[model samples]
Target: MFLAWNEMRRNKIKFGLIIGVLIMISYLLFLLSGLANGLMNMNREAIDIWKADAIVLNKDANQTVAQSSVNTDDINGKFDKSEGLKQTAVIATDGKLKENATVFGIDAKGFLMPKLEDGKLFKKNNEVVADHTLKTKGFKIGDELSLSNSDEKLKIVGFSESSKFNASPVLFTNDETISKLNPMFKGDKINALVVKDKNWKDAQLNKDLEVIEIEDFVTKLPGYQAQNLTLTFMIVFLFAISAMVIGIFLYIITLQKRNLFGVLKAQGLTNGFLAKSVMSQTIIIALIGTLIGFGLTVLTGAFLPEAVPIKFDYLTMSIYGIVLILVAILGSLFSVLSIRKVEPLKVIG
Candidate 1:
């Protein structure tokens, strides 16, 4: 510990550079994880709220509820403990700013109907409850939203929590409003069904329909898997790069301090003591850099717009921090091994 601190104190700028690099890497990783998690939440927040066991969608819909279509036979199938759903995406406008939003047609009394955070659920055919984000966009109770592609209009009766789908705002309405909003999906039909039994794995019930776990349903949402895969690869590669950067930097320093290690060994310092210093140096550097990086991440998140999808999971961040420290310690193995191999006689000779 003394040798590690003495060298770090003597070469403050070199070690500072290492810490800076680590800080940037850790910051990027944390930021990326938050964004990925937030986006995932937005894409499937409604499903999370439903707390449903699984989803039943048309096989042809590619597992996306918005693209699914359930016929009368499918809806009336001898299924038990399920509620039908009619879902679609439409452009909403108030004769001014237009934006895309998702409309969910669910039974007002079904288990899928979330408890209102404010106001009441839809009591009439066209009365609807919207996500609070819509309220931010000038929508409020008693305000009418015009469906651009259809003659149907929605009366906002209430507001729900942060329920979103396909990275867009959500509106909850009855099946009547849904059918009118999109005539093609009209009739006694539904886009999908929500099952209450978590063990509902009746995939082969009908060749045209399939039941899937909630996680699988979320994973198959449009662009959800793609975004996750891309960000995961980037994070993994960044971890590897961090290890390489630390390992190479320490290796170069080890090369420069070969004679110093030999002289210390001659002065009666055991190689084991010198190796402990190297490990201690790695731990200190890793902890300092990661903490600073996390602080910066939180600071930046505070300034970001509300629309930015970022959710901080402190537990996940802590686990990442531990992994980073372990990786850094592993990186310093090259230095530790080099120090252990130092022969005092060779340097003195």
Candidate 2:
């Protein structure tokens, strides 16, 4: 460790340059991760806010909430505790200010509805609560908003945080209002049911119904799985590339110090000491670079535009940091090997 520190102090510029490169790479990885998480939340934040243990969808719907069809009869006595049915509909607003929005039909008094950030939940069929994203589009409490296909005008009564789905702001309304908007969803029929029972998997239901955990249901969202998989693959490959970069750089550094190492060994120093120094140096560099990257990620997220979705989860960031340090240590393995191979006698001669 002392030798490694001495070498770094002696060649500050070279090590600084390597650290700079690592910082850039690590920052990019963290930024991409935040963006990926943000996009995913945009697609499922509405459901995520529900905090339901599981969702019951019609088997024929292929695990899609939008396609599933259920009613009061299907949910009766099916679980230890079941919230009222929830359904979703995509509708365009009448004016140019708002284009497309997802309307969520939830029972007004049910547990699935999110708490309001502003105003209270809807008290009448004509009143509605909406995601705070709608505020950016010139909407406010008491403003009457009309759907593109329907004659009914809904009054915005409240707004909630993180209540978006399918990359659009969500509007909350009762089943009765939804039925008025689209006659197809008649009395007691809904898209799916949110259940809170541990034994849901063992419960026997109609052959046409299927129960799935909320996590699985989120992946089933359109394009969500594919997008997340692509981002995750990119992150993995980037980490691998970082490891290779670190390994190659450290290997070159080790090669330059081969004679010094040989001389130390001739003077009775051990290979294990040199290997530990190399690993310690790698860890220090990696940790500094990763922390800088994390700081930049947080700064960027703080200043990002409201329209841009970017979520920075602490747990996710911590995991990424751990993985980066591990990969960096793994990358130093080649340098350790090079140190182990040094020949004291030949170099001394």
Runs of candidate 1 with Cα error greater than 4 angstroms are 72-80, 202-204
lDDT of 1 by residue, 212-256 (tens): 788888887879999989988988888898899999988888888
TM-score of each: 0.93, 0.92
List the pairs of residues colliding in candidate 2.
none
Question: Among all windows of ten consecutive residues in candidate 1, which has the lowest summed lDDT?
Answer: 71-80
lDDT for every model?
0.85, 0.83
lDDT comparing candidate 1 with the true structure: 0.85
- Which 10 consecutive residues of model 2 have the lowest summed lDDT? 87-96
